[model samples]
Each structure stands twice: as C-alpha cells, then as structure tokens.
Target: MKTIATASMGVTVALSLVGTAPAFAVGGSFHCDRPPIMEVMEQVDGSSALQSIVNQYLVRWEARNATEQCQAYADGRPYDISCMNGRRDWPAILASVPKDYFGRSNESLAAAVRDEKRKGNGLREAMAYCRSVGAIK
Candidate 1:
C-alpha cells in the first residue's frame, strides 16, 4: 500500500497499488471524494478496472444512503422513491458500463434494474457486493 496525497484534492488516499497505480476495488466509497471516481469514469468502458470502480462506488453510495440518505425509508414510513439509494446515480453507472450495454443499445436506467432483477439478482446481490467491500455489516 502506498499513500498518495494530492495537492489539489488535499486528501490522502491509501491504496494498494501495482507500482503506484491505485487498484480499484468494488464497494468502496473513498470518503465520497469524487475525483478518483471521475477520473476512472474517463476510462473506456468494458475494462475490468472500470467495473470495479463502478461497483465500489455504488456500494459506497449505498453505505452513505443507508447510514446517511435513506433515513425516512428506514423509519418504516411509506416507500418514497425520491430518497432511494442511487436514485440519481445513473450517469456514474452509465459511464462505467460496457459501451454496447448502454449508449449503442439505448439502455435506460429502469431497464437496467429490471434486467438485474430478471436475471434473478438485484438487492440480494447488491447486499452481497456491499458486504464484499465491508460497506455494511
């Protein structure tokens, strides 16, 4: 592991790396700092590294949502779609998906969720993925 502190971001990022390149992981939030994530978004889709960044970001968002965004829903109130975790994160997701899986194919966000469910994996798989990154207990 190497410690990197950028002057612009002013945050120290401790990442396990090959040489000095940060190894992206699934289900990580990196303290919600957006630069590293945005940087990865510029990478061409279909790269395994890209997928890891996307997955980890989602899990990180879920962690924040549950601990910090989904309070109303957690209170057992009626489901309010407005506060759903990852509700407005489509760009991040879309930016990281395979080019063919999205832009060229015109995949909508709802359709992607539906496809995940149709494949017999959705929240259940999400929870598992989140756990893989220690985002949740």
Candidate 2:
C-alpha cells in the first residue's frame, strides 16, 4: 500500500510539472539588435525609392527568422521564443510594401537574396533593382 501511494504521488508530481512547464517556458518581451536597413542604405545614397525596397527586404528577413525560430521550438531545439515572437511583426511591415516588389512569395525573395550573395555583389544588385523600379518611384 505504501509503494502504491508513493507511485501515485510521483505520477501526480510529474503531471503537474508537465502542465506548468509551458507557463515557465522561455518566451515573451524580447528585442532584436538588427539595425534599421535605411541606416545602412543611407551610407550609399538617400533615394527614397531604395529606402522602401530595403524596408521590405528587412521585413522579409525578419519573417524568415521568425519562421526558423518557430520551427526550432516545434522540433524541441533550443530557441529564443521571445525573439521569435518579436519577429512576428514581419507581416505588418510586409504589408506596407508594394505588391510587385514582394515577388510571388517570401521564398522568392529569399532565393533572390541567396542568388545576389552567390554573385559576390552581396545585396547591391537587389537594392539597385529596388531603386531602379521606375513604376514605383
């Protein structure tokens, strides 16, 4: 009878811990140090057209980061949940950009960035494309 009682207590404690673990999970109120892309762009030139494109790129970048973090959390990999939550603001920033600039989807933009990096121009080509879009400008 004593063994049974001890086993029951252990089970209860385990269940309690499982129930409350998420409440104590590491998440909420995190900030990113990533600087505004405009600050970086300003060093080159102050074209408002370029600024808008860079802003959209930043938004997509944040969204990508958030997606990776969320996937990490789901996979039981260590991740900063608070930072991921903060990155969730990407949707709002993305909405501010012209639809044409975004391509078919975020993946397309990611691919484009990757291609730009591969060419060794870094993101200059992408930014120039953004700035050169006469229709939007």
State which candidate has the highest lDDT.
Answer: 2
Report the lDDT tens digits of candidate 2 across residue range 94-122.
55445554334334455544443343422
Quote the positional error of residue 90 for candidate 2 in Å.
16
Candidate 1 residue 36 Cα shift, in angstroms, is 20
Clashing pairs in 1: 27-56
Error of 1 at 7 (Å): 39
The superposed Cα distance between candidate 2 and the true structure at residue 16, in angstroms, equals 44
* lDDT value, residue 88 of candidate 1: 39
Residues 36-91 of candidate 1: C-alpha lDDT, one tens digit per residue: 33343333243333333344444444434444322333454433222232243556
TM-score of model number 1: 0.27
Pairs that clash in candidate 2: none
Clashes of 1: 1
Number of clashing residue pairs in every model? 1, 0
- Per-residue lDDT, model 1, residue 44, is 24
| TM-scores for all predictions | 0.27, 0.34
Scored by lDDT, model 2 comes in at: 0.38
